[model samples]
Target: MLKIFQDLRELPKEEQKRSNIRNIIAGFILIITLLIIMGFTTLGGVNTFFETLRHYSETGELLISLDRARLYEQTFEKENSLNSADKAQQSIDQSIKLANTWNTNKNPP
Candidate 1:
């Protein structure tokens, strides 16, 4: 590499200018290639992050549904109201639907 630089320094002005242009073009190509690779990597990371957020949101909804179902059940047990029983059943059905959705999203075919 040292000898190559020494030879470059001894070249004619016109040859030196051509060599410099070629080096600049090569450097630019390298930088563009790296940028393209990084762009793809960053895009994949962003997609994965959003997917994780969606999964967490679905899980939270499922948990909330289950908690509501439990509360409704306790209310029915205490008051023995048919309305409370119906609401509890609805909450349980919502929880099941949410759970199925979460499972499907987590394991896509």
Candidate 2:
């Protein structure tokens, strides 16, 4: 330990500074490389990550709600008939499935 301290003290101040800078740069490069590798290995998981963020954003939520409203509108727009009733039932089932997904996502195991 004493020899190590002596060697450290013998290192020039400028040399120590340069060494620290190199180490910092190396650490940053390592982090960036790992991130790139992870993104590539995950098959565009990074894109999905950003997309999820966008989907949760205010504008994205508004657009999604609008889409849901449009779906309901279409279901209601159909003429009253057995076929229309079947379509409405399908829509209801889909809505339930979506709701279940939401619940599961919010309360993950």
Candidate 3:
């Protein structure tokens, strides 16, 4: 290997240029191969900022729906106690806030 490397270094300029071009092509091939492998293995699945934002909004909507359902169930319960009504109101309020937050463009602090 050492002898081969020395021989390469002693080659003519034209040969060295060919070697350089070959090495560049090999490097590009290696990078593309690694990217393909990563894609197949899902290792290159980094989320973009927009994707993260979309997921966050989706989660918020789901939570709001669940809260609204709980509030509705509480309102229809047999007891119909004042405490339950208050709790239900709180849940509805939280759900509304969550929905508004999702609709707004401002980032959360």
Candidate 4:
């Protein structure tokens, strides 16, 4: 270790300058490499976030449209069944009465 220190102290002036330049260059390269990797990592996370938002928006729009379509379909069905309206209403009334009777008779509190 003493010999190594002595040799470093005896090194040529031009060689010392070159060594300093090399160290500076290596340090700059390492910093730039880290910045590039961080940039890419941030870009990837941003892309994934936007992708998830896009899919969520599309899914919400699809569900809303489906709900509207179902509502229109049910409306159309009721309108087209006008000829059998009275019979349908009577059947619904009878079913409600039956359900009420069962509820009142079974496990009543």
TM-score of each: 0.81, 0.37, 0.43, 0.47
Clash counts for all predictions: 0, 0, 0, 0
Candidate 3 C-alpha lDDT tens digits along 1-109: 9999888877787787999999999999999999999887674345555667786877778586767759666675957787777777777777776667665645565
* Residue range 1-109, candidate 4, lDDT tens digits: 9999888787887698999999999999999999999999999999999967866665555555555555555655778665355544554555556556545544467
Candidate 3 local Cα displacement, residue 69, angstroms = 4.7
Candidate 1 Cα misplacement greater than 4 A, ranges: 1-11
| TM-score order of candidates, top first | 1, 4, 3, 2
Worst window of 10 by summed lDDT in candidate 3: 41-50
Q: Which pairs of residues collide in candidate 2? A: none
The window of 10 residues in a row where model 4 has the poorest summed lDDT is 98-107
Per-residue lDDT of model 2, residues 1-109, tens digit only: 9999888887887698999999999999999999999878797877888767854663444456556655665766765566666655666666666656655655679
Model 2 alpha-carbon drift over 4 Å, by segment: 1-51, 54-78
Which regions in candidate 3 have their CA more than 4 angstroms from the true location?
A: 1-77, 106-109
Q: Model 4 reaches what TM-score against the true structure?
A: 0.47
Q: Model 4 clash tally?
A: 0
Which prediction has the highest TM-score against the true structure?
1
Best by lDDT, which number? 1
lDDT score of model 1? 0.94
